[model samples]
Target: MDGPPPLPLREQKMNSEEKSFLLPKGPSRLPVSGLRLKRPASDENEPPKVDRKRARGPLDPTKRGGPVTAAPCFPKPPPAAPGLRSHRQAAGSRRTVAAAAPKPAAAPAAAGGGEKKRAPWDLKGQVSDLRAKVGIYKEKAQGLAGENEALRQRLNQLEGELKQATARNQQLEGQNSALALELQTCQAQATESLQRVEQLVEQEQQLQETIKSQSQTIRELESAGRKAREAKEDLAAQLEAREAELRLAQESLAQRAQENEALAARKAQLEQKLHESEMERRSLHNAVQELKGNIRVFCRVRPLLSSEKEAQKPGMSHLRFPPDDSKSLVLSKAEESHVGRERKEDIVYEFNFDQVFPPSSSQEEVFEEISLLVQSALDGYHVCIFAYGQTGSGKTYTMEGPDCQDPSTAGMIPRAVQQIFRKAREMEAKGWKYHFTANFLEIYNESLRDLLVLRPERGSELEIRRVSQCTEELHVPNLCYVPVASEHEVLKLLQRAKANRSVAKTNLNERSSRSHSLFQLRIEGHNANRELHTSSVLSLVDLAGSERLDKSLSTGDRLKETQAINSSLSNLGLVITALSNKEAHVPYRNSKLTYLLQNSLGGNSKMLMFVNISPSEENFAESLNSLRFARKVNECVIGTASNRK
Candidate 1:
């Protein structure tokens, strides 16, 4: 078969930039139909040229336009140039290549007698030497030509700029000389003016001195003439008055001596009585200090319905300090006050831990307003917010919202937990960090069960342990404290507990808390400034709703449970009543509710009570009793230290 024709340079330019080892295009890339050759057109058939360049893969820009001629192509590729092939096999492979891809249809290279001639371009042994010398000379010529052009352009620009600079410099120099002359002339004029001013000041000083000497001489003559008239008038009056005054002086001395003796006696009597009265006052003050408890009392009220008469909205029975009367709340001796019946919502009055309500109109809404007090606890104070409300009066809703995620309907517990974690995070300067350990327990079925605890059959019998923030002590018999970091974690815990809570569909709360559930959070941390541990106990307790036997269809097991819930709540009221009166006996041990809150109701704690009241007409009596019990609680004073007023 004949070798392929030489490819045209025009086709090579099309794929010049692609990286190819030899060539990317095939031998047929040329205009095959327009093939120009020595053969006649009559021979319409000839073996087609195989373009081996197709297998070259890609092209390289560096290997662009160069001489190309077909070489012999065998089943195998041509042998490498000269040193690239071995001596024994080089001649045979070269012969095969020249025959396989003949340079062109050049009359078969005029077939020599024995062997075909090789094309001049295929004489690699001769072209290599010529290519190396040509490359070096070409690079040198390009670099010199670039430098020559840059120098010519730079010279022309510099000459033009130099002429313009010279002209500008002359103009600036002329302006500077004129300014320097003006400065010199101004200095001379200032010096002359200064000399004239000094001369005028000296002449004025001389003239003023001459006038002052003349005025002094005239004043001295006037004083001498006035002294002569004064001497004659003084001599006449002095002689007559001296004789009469001597006689009266002797009588007055005798009367003054008697009066002095009487005054001294009266002064001694007043001093003796003053000292006795002071001693009595001090003794009483000391006794009062010993008896009185400085408990902080804050009044919190819930909103009333807009349609109700203003006077009945809060039920006048819940008022501690009259709502419309600000002066009464500010009074040093305000004993009783009126409740605001102004249009609002369900009314609740929260007071101190040791306050009592007589159930009049001034009842305490203990759970309704505790966010403010709990917020203060996060600010580094031991705070306790307890609910004192009848069952079914929204107590559970007040402390721990049944719907915890909703802030508007939030009860005390979720609100308290949210505030504590928030304040702890905000205490940046105190290097304050608070670890919250949550323990949800309920005094239910008269037995303590961890609400977060798995049912006995569902899981192992987990222990309920009490944790002590002091001395890092933890663990309680029925309550286990779980450390929580965020509000979301608390909410999830609440939701889980609510699901696990022993709820019965009662006439009151459909999912009423059957037992006293204590959601206790133990807050302990160090103050950023003092670096000392500050600890507080926070409890959001939801007492089971109070139910009327007549209205409730509860029986059997339900009745017993209701009885247990009521008995414990009653004991709670007694405990508050005893504390309010400063009674030596606080019945904390009377019930589980009171016993659990013993520390909170006593010393150094900021205790607030929310008496949750449901304005529903059906629950009014229980609400009224609840308010009266709350009012009694308002009178009790719990002892505390370090309250930020």
Candidate 2:
């Protein structure tokens, strides 16, 4: 009642603010015990009921880290308006009357004992106090009611908002789930894009490598093309050169063909002229041989011998070569026709022949006269050239020569052989071939010995048989016909024949051949172009020396040799006589010499007789006998020569 000492200004201001302010009580105003702070028309001991159905609110920043505290309590609930505040004021007035009842007594007693004094009873003051208190509590209660109402409204609003918020959260969560799925798809796409980028990078590298290899191949192809182009150029150059050479060869071939054609025409013309000339010459040759007689005789005079030179003749020489003609020989005799006659008056003898060789005439000059007859053998005519004279009258020398050393002195046989060889070789170009056979034999005492045989014994049996009687050409059976190719071969054969010839020492001659040596040449030729064959013979004979038995002073074997020689010579003379007379039976069988020459003497053959004569005065008788025989032979005509083909 003495009003609690006047409140502090700060406290008064806080109370006034509490009364005036509408905000609710905070935790700071709550009692420390279990009781809550009081309010107008509200119970103090009952705690303020919180609506547990309310949702939790946001945290308070002011209460951070503070002790746990409940919401502050306030008076009971009232009407939402100020009516609830009047009721609480009436209740507070009743409580004020009851408190005034004890205040007077306690005040007096305390005054007597000097206790605290009581307030003066002023209605305005008491009412003011009580009113003030009620007002404060009423305001507090109102504020509390207002706060509760606000809180309830807020909770209800929060509940509705929270329901809406929860729905929104659910919608947001669903949206988030969809967004996360989309994000995962985006991430996968991004990852895939990265992988693709890596693959692209690898492909680019491979493309780069491919481009590099292609560049290298392009380089190789370019190089090959260059080489091929160079090779083509070289081949083109070679083709051009070969073309030029072919052109040159064609021109040369054309030229050669033209020349050959011209030459062939000229050859044909010359051959025709030659054929006509050969025919004319052959006819003329035949007529000449006919006029001269088939057996033509030639006389050769020997030069002065050594004995004649030692004993010179006092008068003019008996032998003289004619001044008017070379074919005539004149011999003058100082004595009469008979020996030791007084009426000498210089007997004169003149001889004419086909040819007459003078004492000084060379072998060539003599061969020139007889070479034609030798040539007739090659022309297919059987020809005979016989040396018929006494032993020392140069018969062997004229036929075979002194020796073969001097070519100019080579006789008729050697010259004829050389000519035959030359002609045969020349004819080869004209398509003619010749086979030549040579045989040399000697008739000694009517026995034939082959001169060409390698060796001969003293008593060898050599047979000489005649060819068939039906054949005209004389052939000796078993006679060796050695084939000869050259002039030297013929000369060799002649040497062999000479070595084998029968010779003896006689009074009139130191070495006289005691046998008739016959060298036979058989020529068989064919003209390949004409296909005509021809056969002929050339019989070259060197007869033995014709000697008088008394003049030679022979006896014993020498006499027998002389008799045989004389007998063959006499038979040859008889055969000649019979041929000259054109008798039906010419004595060809009378002697071996005549028999051997049967075909050459009287048949279709040309016979040339060389009558060699000595110029020595001591051999006048033998010379006269040879001259007379030559004259007889010159007059004889055996037959017309015919070539055998």
Candidate 3:
């Protein structure tokens, strides 16, 4: 039989494309012998059908003028049969038939002129159509070949995976059985766990109740604590108030006590002044009021010396002070006292003064009495204070004192200078400026010498000149008047002058001052508020101790010093006597001491005398003499003291 007729070019192209599309995209790894044609679903048990449509587009050499291209053939694969061996047999038979179809294509080329001769265009179209089909089939084959290689690898991998899945399924089946048993056990345990959870929830509710109760109790405690703290704060405030009141009361009491003490002291001072006024009117001459300006006399008794204490006779007291009057003192001998034995009074020698200080009185007590006069000097009143006594009678001690270490016993000179400097500072608020000059001099052997200056020799002469008659004040020429600002500087100057003083050891004293030392402080002040200037002089004199020639037992220089001392003291007595007698011509020129003190004694100056005496039986006669002299001084009337403002 002849082969089926060749298909038209368009129909052949459509059939070729259909065959390509229907064929599996991937090729089988097996040879074409293992391939099978697909069977119709309606014919399940029958062999696969021969697909002539796929075989229709064979290469026809007689139909093309040019070189002929062979048509690509694609066999449809059948469904997989139950047995791969029987299916592979059937595929091998079909492969043989397909291989024979291309033989007929070669027969047409050999037919020569007997084949239908196609036109050049028709041949070219058929050839071109065959070429296009060949190209499409080639592209599909290449793609399928690549896909086949990938599919082969995927198939191998899938086979291994399937084996693993099978084993896994078996394992899972076993695991599921075990899991079902575990689930049953877990359900039993979950029931027990739920019961425990229920118990824990109940315990939690009880714990929350306990926390609530504890919180309520804590709140109550906190409220009570707050109240207690407030009460404590109130008590503390009250305690502070009470303590403040007590402190104020204590301060008030102390202030009142101080006021009482001040009042009592003032009363005593007034009483003393009243008594002095009475005495001044009674004994100071008929010109009592006028004589008030005279030098005030105060007598101080020195304590008994050690030697006198040893020599004192038993049952004898030489010094006597009147019980009722502190201004009068009496000296009596033991032999003359007949109060108990003879019923006759003793030869009592009574002397009176402005003030009499006992030996027991302190330096401060003596200073308090003279402090007012020193203040007057700062007030522009010229003041003179002199200490007079026999040897070892404490005249120097009263004026310069024993020591400056103790302020209570520092003596009048230091205390007076200190007061001036202090008052000057205090008065600065009142616009007062003060200038103070200190001049220390001594009258030795009736000659004046600068005690503050350093001398090459003990007997060096010093310059002394009288001021002009027009000037009432006496000025010592070339006197070393040192400027002193503070009490310390004044003390230093006083110490230096004292070291330079003429002193000698005698039978009477260990260190007896042989010359009369005069320490003068002149003050000048300007008051800016009042537009006034003031000038004042404060003279502190330590007279040489008076002594008898026989008692002193002096020969050469000592004798001369004793006579000079006696002469000056006598001149001083005469000046007082003349003033007491109110004479027109007072013998101030009788001695250098008298002449130098003329203004201070009888002129416009405030003068004070301190008669120092020994409270010893052996010196009873000298003590009596000193008291008598002090009596004369007390009675003298100089002139009214004036302020140089």
Question: Which stretches of candidate 3 lie above 4 Å from their native place?
Answer: 1-293, 314-316, 334-345, 457-460
Compared with the true structure, what per-residue lDDT tens digits does model 3 show for residues 180-296? 575566456556655655665567666785766655655665565566556556655755654554454344345335534644554444333333332232222213222334578
Which candidate, 1 or 3, has the higher lDDT? 3
Clashes in predicted model 2: 0
Location of the lowest summed lDDT over 10 successive residues in candidate 1: 24-33
Q: Tell me the spans in candidate 1 whose CA falls farther than 4 Å from its real position.
A: 1-369, 402-404, 457-475, 581-585, 642-645
lDDT of 2 by residue, 387-480 (tens): 9888788888888888546888887888899988997886674457999989999998888888877554435556646567876655666677
Q: Supply candidate 2's per-residue lDDT for 151.
A: 38
Residue 483's lDDT in candidate 1 = 86
Candidate 1 lDDT, 1-645, residue by residue in tens: 267743322232112212111322112101112333243443334444332221111223123223233332224344344343334243543443233221233322221112222233433312322232233223323332333343344345434534543454454456456655755665565566556446645766676765565446435434533443343245335423332332322322332334334334433433333333323332332232223333433323344444434536345343445443321221111233356444344445333333222223221133323444565455445556655555555556556664536666565566667767776775542245677788887787556677886676334433433355453233456355678999889988888787777877786665666787777777777544444565667666667877768777789988988888888888877876777677898787667677767756665555665566655444556656665665576566665434321
Task: Name the best candidate (by TM-score).
Answer: 2
Which prediction has the highest lDDT against the true structure? 3
lDDT (C-alpha) at residue 321 in model 2? 76
Report how far residue 261 has shifted in candidate 2, in Å: 7.9
**Backbone clash count for every predicted candidate, in the order shown:** 70, 0, 2
lDDT of the structure predicted as candidate 1 = 0.50
Candidate structures ordered by TM-score, highest first: 2, 3, 1
